[model samples]
Target: MDITIEDKFHASCFTLKKEDILKFDKEDNGPINNVLIGIEHHCYGVRFFDDRHGLSVEMFYINGKGLLKGDIIQLQVRDPQYYQLLLRFCVLLADDYKEVNALIAFNTFQNKLRGFLEKRGIFTVTSLELRQFKGQSAVMVSPSPRGIVKIDFINQKEFYVDFFNKIANKPIEKGKEHVYLMVNNDTGLIKIGRSNNPVYRERTLHSKEPSVHRIAMWCCEQNIEKKLHIIFKDKRIRGEWFRLSLADLIEIEKFMDSV
Candidate 1:
């Protein structure tokens, strides 16, 4: 239950036990690695770019067994942002167990995970591609905004139901522009205005729309509402959509204030 990679080109080696392998698998339960073991026998080796650092080809292995001695497998690694993108892509592109298993397997065989990503409007980065930039750091820049957000009335409704269910400490309803920090199903952060375009802003949260900062984006995406509550704006926040519940509106207002 261990996977090892002999970095033939770089002359480095990596090893991990089954538990560690499983941990990575839990992070992404795709067959790209798992199938490498059950079929190809050894985790396939990939040479990838860590965009966080300038372009260097690093070696990674998918764990299994049976890779032919001296056989070479090419691979790529993108920044952590790409990792989140892949998670969502895998779910969207492969909705069932079989489709998921197949595509994950195919992605390994094609050795073009980078190219595949780029075609989908997701720019792939290499250390070399990054090194060309000025004053680069390991920090990630968000992707361009999609301008579309899937507001979960269910979650919003539940928030209101739970809020009014309380005997005391009832949230006050007010006529003001209230903004809240909301997270999409993708765990992307957004500043939802009681009136502005929450969906559109959510899309740009990654790329350019600039209302919320990095910390606020991180907080909401992590589903930690309590920490977000203290940042409520005591002032009137305005936007176009104003019929939202008091609790939900206030929660959003607090988050906006915090930001």
Candidate 2:
């Protein structure tokens, strides 16, 4: 059996109704995918679902971040290659679920897959997956275990640029630093920071058990994150976290997009 790992997730916008944006107006909250990880999850991990030989495929989804929250990371194991399977699932969703409420169906499928993987000693990440009480009294948490691994931004430099360029549908100057926005959906608190490893920072926040939904990440070398922090200091909740309205989000969006 031949297998390949996609180095990066395709960072693209998902379509949703205006009603959705209003409902989820907690500042650029994810924008929705087919059968998403959670109600406000930003990162959507999509890949194959095999029946012949169940391979080890894992991605971190902590509540409103990747998958769902809790000890179990609920997600859909979809094989888009199999149109029949997708069609069957869609039909089932429409027939069984109310108004094709895909969350129930997709969650079921993902949970079932997780069960299968568990039985086979394969693991994807949930909130509690990386946590462990070691030895006497220390609690050690790994943000990206092998199961829910982090993207290597340094090594795969070109891929990063290419992915962003594709998202913009225009060429971007390869940047030396990245400024990102992460939101805590539960509290409606947003974090604006600069980090080379934004994903790692996100998972670290996940360890604290906030619904961290990654809003957007932009590559820039300047101290823009700092500048934004100072600009929005009045709106600051604490530290890097700011209480931003949708309009403020748009302003920040304009700034990031400019870079």
Candidate 3:
């Protein structure tokens, strides 16, 4: 588990790829491994995955502008000592789940472990697993009766803002808005599209053509829970509409199937 740690002042020193870029695409799921230069410095790395297209990773803090370079960059994994300690701690807590004193031990260890995972890009699960539990506590660490709890992204600051905006339906404005959205409560294919005039089109058009309903239907037929949420996207530009590709839909279905 010993992993190398790379340190440099600029991103030119690191490699970037479609796999890495997808991994860091903040639009789908907040990238995993918000790697920082040091304990206090900003994150230089993030990870993304697309089962259909493959993985994409990115370095968000490359010399400040956040540009992707073609050079190959190595990700630092957790050290053997750290991982062993974590696995042992998890085993202990799992064994003591019913004990009253377990709460104290669990909280202490869980916090420490979470920080450890975030630091080294080694969580109890992958970004997919983390996203499955986006707002609630980790089921692996902290069991829940519902079994379907939102992931706890308190540490992932980006998650909260998008969650809030979706709940509020606050005007996303007319621009190039990047959104990773899902539909759960509604029992049909949920359409995902962007409208240059969202106010007129989304509000007025209800024909269901080119809608996400088809995607939702496929998920439903497969017995997938339709829990939809939006991930963030860049909106610097405006007045263009985009819809999820059929291939992307297939990827979504696969992600749903795994969960």
Candidate 4:
């Protein structure tokens, strides 16, 4: 199956130029940038990134064909942090077929993803949006701090469930300030920032289109937060948001504790 179309994709990912990838489908939400792709043998591997390196998912395997007869599409997620996101996305492709060899259920997972990223006004969570929008449910997707996180939105629930599940340190007692890491559901960016009140900052950033939720917080001074910015300057995509991975995030938390 031909995974990529000539004009469909902007260009090869060697340049790491976001403009190289066509963004006709989505203008804001449900978009990706700086994609790196490769193929080894029959395996198609890709890395999706934001601005920061840590926030990216690399070596995502979209198997070319099935095991024996080129049937049963396979999606392999190597990154531990993004397993939930990949799993959820792959589930949809799986649902449409019991066993499809010709197109391997949908040409390939890459096609499904390219369509999701490039198509205009296509809701990956069709059923969820149908119920929410048609039902006139204005209830925005809110991420819970603890306990079982109710699935509100696709990306929203993934980060909360995966990132907040650990609940690293206890909540910031009842006192001082702290640097916070907020996750944006739509853009897939993590904001490493601070505020007099992290909760208030989160409220200011929260929204329906591009949802923002504070996933982690550290009890540290503003200076310490600045230190983090310097340390991860390479990952800094913009002001406070950094393309951070799970390990990078963990290291930030540990640094906060040490300081």
Q: For candidate 1, report its TM-score.
A: 0.22
Q: Lowest summed-lDDT stretch of 10 residues in model 2?
A: 149-158
Ten-residue region with minimum lDDT total, candidate 1: 146-155
Kindly report which residue stretches of model 1 are placed more than 4 angstroms away from their true locations once superposed: 1-11, 32-53, 56-59, 63-110, 116-259
lDDT of 4 by residue, 193-237 (tens): 877677767777774434777777766677977888999998788
**Runs with alpha carbons beyond 4 Å of true place in candidate 3:** 1-70, 79-124, 134-169, 172-259
Query: Model-by-model lDDT, in order?
Result: 0.35, 0.46, 0.32, 0.46
| lDDT value, residue 191 of candidate 1 | 34
Model 2 clash pairs are: 61-67, 63-68
Error of 2 at 221 (Å): 1.7
Ten-residue stretch with the least lDDT total in model 4: 68-77
- Residue 4 of model 3 has an lDDT of 39
Error of 4 at 233 (Å): 0.2
What is candidate 3's lDDT per residue for 21-60, written digit by digit as tens?
4455454332222321222212223333324222223223
TM-score of each model, paired residue for residue: 0.22, 0.34, 0.22, 0.43
lDDT of 2: 0.46
Per-residue alpha-carbon lDDT of candidate 1 for residues 201-231, written as tens digits (9 for 90 to 100): 4456646533322111221232343333333
